[model samples]
Target: MYRKQLFLLSLLLMLLQTAAFAQNNKLRVEPSFWWTGMKDSNLQLMLHGNNISTMQPVFNYAGVEVKDVVKVNSPNYLFLNLNISGAKPGKFNIQLKQGNKTVHRYSYELKQRAAGSANRQGFTSSDVMYLITPDRFANGNPKNDSVKDMADKLNRNDRSGRHGGDIAGIIQNLDYIKDMGFTALWVNPVLENDQPKVSYHGYSTTDYYKVDPRFGSNEEYLELSKQAKQRDIKLVMDMVLNHIGSKHWWMDDLPTEDWLNFQDEYKTTNHRREAIQDPHASEYDYQLQTEGWFVESMPDLNQENELLATYLIQNTLWWIEYADLGGIRMDTYSYPDPEFMSEWTRRVMDEYPNFNIVGEEWSLNPAIVSYWQRGKKNYNGYVSYLPSLMDFPVQNAMVEALRDDEKSWDTGWLKLYNTLATDFLYPEPENLVVFPDNHDMDRIYTQLNQDADLTKQAIAYILTTRGIPQLYYGTEILMHNSEKGDHGIIRTDFPGGWSGDKVNAFTGKGLTKEQLDMQQYMKKLLNWRKDAKVIHTGKLTHYAPYKGVYVYFRHNGPEKVMVILNKNELPYELELEKFAPQLQGVKQTTDVISGKAYNLNQSKLALPIKAPLILELK
Candidate 1:
């Protein structure tokens, strides 16, 4: 009877201990690790556990102090305001207790930062960026195509399904990108998007701190950044601050009741971009534009929450330092609260002053795009520290000019010329990002009615025009979609990305003569622009189009280069007298493309038919 009673008591104790262990398993901490040295001394550590707010926490670590503990309305969450200004690189622990008994102990680590992390250089006008959709770029590892635990699986045939492109594929093709003379690479978001389907685009983020297993591991992403840097190529990360995937881990158990906007209702956004800048806009309309969700699948983030704001700002800084990122391309820039975005951009710039961030404000109006760029003196007295913005005006105008059938004051080439005339509205127009087309639009070739000559002219304009130039992948070999405005077809897989692909662009296996010519033309133009200092920061002077010819000069000090866009099928005589201000004292000109020589002593120069002339004068 004594032995039986003793065994029963021991079993009872074991059961109680097992229950306690299960309860502790619910505890969680974000940003699992941080660096010891940082510009800001304050660090807000968000603690999550089962009824964690009921406990008091204490830690005794040299150079680290828990200044305050904040408890919100949620019993399962706690925020620790820690001052780690004097902390050294090491590990420490904080004990959470309910009175005398210790409920849990959390271990934290601080790491040493990389060399010159704060002063890292960012993408600039001198660098031409190559934008890529990783899922459509290339597939290097077949094994990681369909991760078991991930909800989505590989289905290459499905336009929107995961097509098995991974970081390894990008690494394999780094040489191809480098040899093409692109100095910077902008990859679409690669964060964990654990949605059940259509998650390949990566905009719907499920995990903020983790890379999607379907794409690759976080370490693999770091390896990619390291390798690209070694080849003198910079990496630009795309980040979304407006919303997150509906399947996000926090959606089921949010940190706070106000974590998401319009949580009680599922109202879609008006997408009326002018609401942000409209003078007579109703408060209700502005609220609807800012507070409404982007889509049913994406829940809008409420940046007005101070805690959430700090969380996002820290998250971006962590990635910048962790991945050693060269720049950040923020998605949906104007959707968030302007005050919070201003603070966010200011904080990031404070940390890395030299680093650049290009915000996406997709309005075709120059005034709307200029409002977000830094140094714009807005009429509303709003200040923005954002360094760059996507030049949608230039992009739209260029396409219209290419598609127009006739040349007139407001048609054809003048459409583009008039669009650029508004440059005075921007404080730093040269910092804008200009491109012909991107993943979101139809390919440039398709927009030009598949005319190779017009396509070459567009490409030449994008490469030589002021501001940074970004080319979407597959543009060189003339990739286009059969149907217009189909994003899935527009972001088609690179020919050689997958296994068993008959044509290999990397090896030039089965490309047509025109495709090969386009590829070589791209290679030459890009390679030359890599060393062309005048195009990077030169003053621009353009003469009005005269008889189907539009001419412009990019000159800096003594260096001079002229670009001519001619639409006439037959050769036209261009009078040198019209460009006296730009072409004065110029004796001879050599074509940068064909190396053909021209004498300025003649009164008129014969411009080639439908040819883009990039001339270097001496």
Candidate 2:
């Protein structure tokens, strides 16, 4: 008995000693693993631990060479630049040694690249993206609502609090989204936002590589991509390269002094985006606009630091490869160093030539927004490789056009016509992502003052326009905010997402007649758009607004679509003579909305009052 007890004590001591050793050498490696076959032969691994910079890393693997070891000001971090040009799919141990003894051993893995990952296609004009805030969308697993380690807790009553919606919730609603005629899913950032409060928005990222535990694991995010792809729905990830949550792991022990802009101070941005392209802008204004923090809780990253830039670039690539993303919606695109952003997009596009990335410049001026597009000839010699940008000018104009009264030639639909006329500024205006409203703005329904007819007109205009269309989650149901410009209210929870809810938007339970009608109306319009090739790739020809009516045609060879927006309070007979160029041989047209036939042989066509009309020219 004594011998047995002694043996048990010895085994316990050995286990405790092993645990202690692991605890002492615990290392957090950004990009925990990598794939073997990437177009970019180089990979930068960021290692963070207790005094890890003091030790030397030793590893031996075929076709994998540690080209350089970069140590920053922090004693706990080490950046390893590896050349994996000829590396095969396998695993090897990277031993961190103190003198001759290996103090820590990290098992590094090189995964095989997914087939055709390099040439994966991105979201385009053909797709109608559904923008979802995961935390407000649904709650599939209640268990992960309030993770023990995360600072934020579940509180559905609080508009800005975490509401337990996660990856599982989105997974559960995939069918609904597919049936609704959306081909792309643009989910807000799922990265860890371990903030003490208001972390539900996901704009403040705490960890880049890991998905928030409240949302789900990184595997689940990959699963979302898989399931979305199966339904022919592309997944566009929302990324933030400008700033990070204040509680990020690196904040406690920054890798270097220049890791963050204004590292020792907190200064909010002036938000003067024009300074970037202004020829006479002062250095002070330009520096403040680019380097200042977004908010006190969000630290602006210093992309000028080569190591930090490489780290961010690698993180983006890692997510794209891991999640098999269809595209990326980079948040606050102008806030980052333009030079770094150019390089970032260049590297990403170099690896995946066909992929798309849309940046949010949030400027109402077309010239300002156009400068960031890929092929624009800027006066400042600033070149960009970015493929797409959010069409903020068009969005603003559309909203104003729908709401403004036709008191003068410059009011109402003329606003939209004039705005679109400036499309000549963009190198590829068709590639832009046009929307009625997004997560950061007032809900479209509310913006239109809850006028369902006006809302329909806005929706029809966005869908038929010459750019990729994106709609918020509840826009179809006319979801409106009681208060304007409140982000939390703008991104309210979907009615059917939560359990035991009185009204369920998903199941069409207890919805009002207007809501149901709008839902069905959007369904029919979207499905029709799904097969409308002319609307996808056609050349747009728009006529100036006449008598509170805006007319446009999308023509591709023999296929043609005529979209008419009538804001008249009474029925108006549209003179067909002006549109004869487009309706030359058309005798009759089909209403895409109501599926009714109208004879176009007459000199005039009667249009309903205050309604939008989409006619298929046959």
Candidate 3:
């Protein structure tokens, strides 16, 4: 019995030693894998482990070499600069050692690139974007609604809480989206937010390399891309490069002091957008605007750090290649350092020449937005390779114009006309995203004062305008925010997204007559516009608003579409002679909405009150 006890004690000691060694050798390598034949041969691997900086990395793979090992201020982190110039698609072992004693061994993989990945086409003006808040869209998989490891659990009652929407829901509803005539799907950030509260919106990224488990797995996100592509629908990912959640794993052990902006002394951003363009703007203001934390809960990233920049760039490329994204909607474009933004855009564009990236610069001034487009000639001599920008100026103008009752120099339709006139500021004006409203603003229906006619007019304007058009989810059924600017209310649950909801938008169950009509009208407009190439890449011309009517024409070589918006309470008679330049040879026209034929050669045109007439002329 004593001999057996001694043997048991020896076994326990051996097990304890193994546990200690495992704990000491625990290592984390980011970008777990990479691809061969990339445009850039250089790859920077971020390694994190206990006292990893004290170890030497050994690579015995052919065509792969560790050019340099950089040890930062933190002993727990090591940056390995590797050159994979002639490396083929295969796996190789990288072992970390402390003076010939192997501490940890990792098998790194180099994946094969997909065919034509470098030349994938991105979303364009011809595609209509459907902006969806995933949490509010649909709950397809209830099993993942509450994850044990995730901080925020499912709370359907809380307006700002997670509501259990996952990529499975999106994959399930691709037909509904495709049938709705939206050629592109722009889902708000699906990355891991993993915060304790307010994690539904997904802006506060906790893990750059992971998809939020509460929503779905990384494989599920990739499945969405594949399924969406099969239906001829493009996927545009919303990316936040400015800041991350305070609860990020790195917060406990930062790689370096400079990995974040304003590390020690906490400072909030000034939100002075003009500082980026104001030539005489003080360096202090510029630094505050670009480097300051967005909010106390959000820690700003420091793109100025070369290692951090490389990591961010690699993360973006990995997502693009892994998920097969069609485009990227970069959040808070102007909030980052301009130099870094330029370099980031240039590098991504270099790899995928046909890919599109639209930056969000929430400035009402055209000059501020124009400065970020790829080919803009800024007076300050600043250059940006960003291909597109959110047209906030046009959106704000459209809302204000629809709400005004009277026509004036700066009010009513003139606001929209003048806003479009500023297109000269953009090198590719048609690339801008024109929208009636977005997730951040009140619904277009509410902005139009609940007037159905005005709502239809706004939709027609954006769809026919000289830019890519984006529609917020549930806009077809005229969803509203009774709380006005309340973001949570504005991004409310889609009526039929849940299983037991009273109304089902998918099936058109329990809907009012007005809602049904609006949905049908939107369906027709979008389906018709899908094949309208004139409106896609046409030349636009507008005549000044007379009385309460505004008229515009979108024309190509042989196709022409004339849009007339009558905002007056009473019917108006318009003289066709005034539009002889566009209508002289046209005799017959069809109203796209009403399906009624009109003789354009007649002396006067009769227009119904508050009706938007989109006529295709021959």
What local distance difference test score does each model get? 0.90, 0.94, 0.91
The CA lDDT at 167 in model 3 is 86
Ranking by lDDT: 2, 3, 1
Residue-level lDDT of model 2, residues 34-81, one tens digit each, is 998898889999988789899999999999988899888988989999
lDDT of 3 at 108: 95
The residue-level lDDT of candidate 2 at 400 comes to: 92
**Could you give candidate 3's per-residue lDDT for residues 402-458 as a string of tens digits?**
888664566788888888888888999999999998999999999888888899999
Off by more than 4 A, model 1: 1-24
TM-score of each: 0.95, 0.97, 0.97
Q: Cα RMSDs of all predictions?
A: 3.1, 2.6, 2.1
Count clashes in each candidate, considering only residues at least 3 apart in sequence or on different chains.
0, 0, 0
User: Which is the better candidate, 1 or 2, if ranked by TM-score?
Assistant: 2
- Worst window of 10 by summed lDDT in candidate 1: 402-411
lDDT over C-alpha atoms for residue 254 of model 1? 86
In candidate 2, position 132 carries an lDDT of 98
